[model samples]
Target: MEEFEIDPQDLLLENALRVVFKAAEMLDAEALTPSQLKDLSGALRDATEIVLSIETACGCDHDHGDEEAE
Candidate 1:
């Protein structure tokens, strides 16, 4: 039997995305107060940073070869 392994960076990115999605859902519920909204905004920002960091660590560049033309 063969076992498959998931990359740690990929797993971290997935979890970060999940956190952002959950925060979005909370924002969509329209039941939070102004303070809650501010806190969630911070949480979302942190999650986004984590996702970007993981992408950088994985060498997933977003340039898409456009820079080469310049």
Candidate 2:
């Protein structure tokens, strides 16, 4: 058996990623017009940037989760 260690900072980033993925899944990509897709892309990018900023401000490593999952 193997034991795993979890970091609080990584957990926060994971939660943020989960929220974005869920929101993206809810949107109907195919139904979006060119203009709508442009707007959605900008919104999603902004949301992700904000989350990244939060992670950085908290002094959390962005790649922390990837290392743990390996």
Candidate 3:
């Protein structure tokens, strides 16, 4: 079997994505007002950019090339 290595930044990014997904799942997109939808969209965009930046800074691939299947 091949051994796998985990990068701290990769873990962080994964956790961040999980949080974002959970938050999204909790909200009813169809029921959101226009303004609220806009705000949520902006927040998600910001979160995505921040996570991407951190991944880059840590030299981790966007696809988490080094991450093992859980």
lDDT, ranked from best to worst? 1, 3, 2
User: Which candidate number would show the highest lDDT if scored against the true structure?
Assistant: 1
Give a tens-digit lDDT track for model 3, residues 1-70. 9999998777778877876886587584557778877777877887788696885576534566445554
**Backbone collision tally, model 2:** 0
Candidate 2 runs further than 4 Å off:
1-26, 59-70
Quality of model 2 by C-alpha lDDT? 0.68
- Write the candidate numbers in order of decreasing TM-score: 1, 3, 2
Taking the tens digit of each residue's C-alpha lDDT, what string does model 2 give over 15-64?
A: 76775775577574457678876776776776687676765576545665
Please give, for residues 1-70, the per-residue lDDT of candidate 1 as tens digits. 9999998877777888888889979978879999998988888888889876765565655664565698
Off by over 4 Å in 1: 60-70
lDDT of each: 0.79, 0.68, 0.72
Clashing pairs in 1: none
Q: Could you tell me every candidate's TM-score relative to the true structure?
A: 0.66, 0.48, 0.50
